[model samples]
Structure formats: structure tokens, C-alpha cells
Target: MQLPVETTDSINKISELRNTNLQNILKKEIDKNALWKGLVAKNLMAIGIVDLTDMSNIKYAGINDNLMMYAASLPKIAVLLASMDAIENGELEDTKEIRKDMRLMISKSNNAATTRMIDRVGYEKIEAVLRAPKHKLYDEETGGGLWVGKRYGGGGDTNREPLKNLSHAATTMQVCSFYYQLVMGNLISDERSKEMLEIMKDPALHHKFVNTLDKIAPRAKIYRKSGSWRNYHSDSALVWGPNRRYIIVALIDNDFGEKIIRDLVVPLERVMKKARNLEKETKI
Candidate 1:
């Protein structure tokens, strides 16, 4: 099924969705946990959330959203977008293997499949797509967003991001913008966004955000992608349900980052719920 559009001319980009009350509620929720607050103080964890319950009046809240960190497989999303762009432009051949690999690369976070897809599209192509003005998924001027400068596996030259030299890196802000633009059907095209979302739907690995979400919102349709390597853990998802239409992105660097992300769901949900009530109060 096609995703719904959530943009007005005045608020086309995700950057335009910032809401002060939502930001305050989000901060209050995060600070309630001493350990989480400590991590925020240390710049080891970053979270970005968007309340899409009312698509016409989106609300955004974030903490250290632009603090770029090594994001491991999360940047594979850059490869995914580049591949889609190539296929659309007829710069790369669309094949059955490519389609299967795309699903595996995203749904299972398959390194071998990701590496092959990267080789098919090339790092230069991915870089161009990100740096392109239309997408700007990675921009040095904006603290450097999603980046894939090296192959997922081994045996290739490393083209690290210029700002941080991270082989693969991302910031919660950029990731949040990604899902925002994606669902808005502005990623390549509406049809392409749907295809990408199809690949991301119902992720295979159930951990971090998905692990908790599966229990709390069993019927929610979750389009997600996540990554983990050593102490670096990251998760991003556009969750669509009755009253839970929102986007959540977290990037953390700590031994307990995985658990931290899983634990963040309920509190963030509370923030969204309260934001909704605050909107209602203003209307009444």
C-alpha cells in the first residue's frame, strides 16, 4: 500500500516540524532517567522523534540529534537509497538478484548482500546521491548526516566521511529527516518510497526498538532499520498505528546502548501522548 502524505507547502522538510512543547516534553522524559541523562551529557547517545499523529501539524523533539557517531549497518540505508535512485535513472540495471539482495540487506542487515549492492552501485554513486542538493542526506555543512564510506564486509578501499572519518556514520536528525521525507513520498518518488518501505517493513531481527515495540504495539506496522557493532547501537523506525504514527531514531555508543534504546520506547510514547493532549488543550 502507498504511504500517506504529511506535508503542507509551509512545512515540507522534516526540519520544519520542530515544536517547542514537544521538545520540552521529550527532554523531560529523557532527563527522568539519570543514566540516560548522563549519556546525553557525555554526547554518547542521541535521539530524534517526530509526532506524526497529526500529519498536518507534525511535532519534532530531539536530543543531540546532530552528534554524528559510528552507525555501523545503519548507513546501509544510504546504499539502499542510492540503489533506488540508480534504478530510477536507468544508471543501473534492475534485476531479480538486486531486488532479493535489497530485501536481505535491509530486513536482515545482511553484510554480504549489502556489500554486493554497494559494489553494484559504487561508493561514488552513493556519495553523489547523498551530497546532491535534492537529498543532502550527507552534508558537511550540517554536521554530516548518513554516510557509507566503506564496504559492509571486508576487501575494499575505505573512503571515510570527510568530517568524522567514520566508515559508516549517521546522526539522529538526518535519520529522522530520512523517514520523514520517505513517508512523504519525496524520496526519489512516491512509488520508489513505497518500494523502499516494503523492504523495510517488519524487520527480521527483533531487538532494541523493535523488541519492545513488538510487545507494546503488536499490531503497529513498523518500517524499520537498525545496527549494532560493539558499543555502537542504532535504531530508526517509522511506526504507523491507530494513534502511534511517529518516527523515532536513536544512536548510542555504550555497552548498554541496546537496552537503552529498548527502554526508550514507552517514555517517548508518553511524550507523544502528552504532546497530543497539549495540542487538544490549545484547541479547546
Candidate 2:
């Protein structure tokens, strides 16, 4: 599937703004403390930062464009958009069943619920929606030659190659781009975007990401979604502050600690808080 292409003008502008500030932030971190080392030991990872106030202002640090890791639940944002688009188009009824599973798939990250939602939304429709202009959903399997096997009764593993799995895998850059597109009202209507944001606001589903942030910046309101598979884990979300909103996505593919919330999650959350504070002080 041909995913949506970002606008050249927007891309150029965002690239310039992000690149200009990215180095400064990195330098400050290196001078103050060596936080990057902790991130480095956790296998390969990527971080994409965007100013939610203005999509054109964006920054990417650490393997920004590299298609290195699996998307895992990160793609759920696309599924969420597809569901909202279906509802808006009157193609799928927002019946009780649809509503229930939509909540489960997105809010709770329920694998079975997500699978059923995928069946209802139809793979083709989801593809088309993502392939639209300025969208960011890409066909990972075709590019990497990876095969993702179906989940066995929700938890069992299937004999499959990591690259082919469509159920849960995506590049870090692609995932961040998707959120950017949504915030810009490029992929779906504004009303639909707001609806999706509401679903993301559910605290129950944001445990992994929120738990981390709560410890550091408890006052911030976070709308986020996270996914994990074996050694791979990802968290993507929009962080809201009194005067700013930022989009943060972090992916780690290594055995760090017992729980993702403790090891990778808290660290990422602290980094985000640090970034947010820097942005505020610098007024970038």
C-alpha cells in the first residue's frame, strides 16, 4: 500500500526547525548528565519529538529516520483513526459491539479486541485510509520481509519472522508521523481527531506511559497509547501542559528490567519531562 506522503513544504519547515534545536537539546543533556548512555544500552531505540501546537515545528533525536524496530501496539493509532473514519463515513455502525471492542483495543491494548476490530474495519479499508495523502501508515512487511504470525488465543506465540508481522510493528518515525498527521487534521476530520483524542485520554489504557509520567510530572495531562511484544516495547502519546503540548514516542528493544513501566517507561517519561521543561524555558 502507498501510504500518505507528507507535504514537501511542511516537511522542509519542520525539518529545519527540529534540526536547529535538536543539537542544542542533546548538548545540554550531555553536559548536564549522560542520559543518552542509559538509552543506548537498551538495544536500539528511536525518539521523535513534535510540537503539538504546530506540526511544522518538529525534532527527532537518535535514529530519527532509521526503520529499526517493530511497531508493536504503536499502529493502534491507525486502527483507531480507521474506526473513527468508518463511523464518520457511515460505513460501520458504532453499535454496542463496535464501541466495546474499540475501547478494549485502544484503551486496554487488548490483543483479541484489536484483532476483532481489524476484522470489522477490513484490512483494505484500513490500508486505504492510511494510504491517503499526508498520512504515515506504511506497509512494514513488504519492505523488511518480516512475517508476523497470528496471536494464539491472545498470548501464545506463533512461528513467524519479526518483520512480517502486521498486527504489531511499525517504525518509530512512522509512528510519530502518524500522530503529527492526526494533530494537523490531515488524515481525518477534526471532529474525528477529537474523538480519537478522547479515547486516548482514558487513564486505564495509559497505565504504562502514565505511570512513568505520574512519578515525574504528575500535573501534566497525557493522552497516550503503548504496545509491547516480547523484547520490544513502544509508547507514543501527546503530552499536555499548561502552556504547551508535545508528542513523544520512545521504542526500546531489549531486556532491561522485569516490568516495562519501571525500566524503560520511567526513564522515557523523565526524558520527556526534561524535554518539556526545556522547551518551556527556551520557548522553542
The candidate scoring highest on lDDT is 1
TM-score of each: 0.97, 0.72
Residues 109-187, candidate 2, lDDT per residue (tens digit)?
8778877776677666766776555553554432321112344135543333244444555565566666665555455
> Measured by TM-score, how close is model 2 to the native structure?
0.72
Q: What is the C-alpha RMSD of each candidate to the true structure, in Å?
A: 1.5, 6.4
Evaluate all candidate structures by whole-model CA lDDT and list the values in order: 0.89, 0.58
Show the lowest summed lDDT stretch of 10 residues, model 1. Answer: 2-11
Residue clash pairs of candidate 2: 71-169, 71-170, 72-168, 72-169, 146-163, 146-164, 147-164, 147-165, 148-164, 148-165
Clashes of each: 0, 10
Screening candidate 1 with a backbone cut-off below 3 angstroms (N, C-alpha, C), the clashing residue pairs are: none
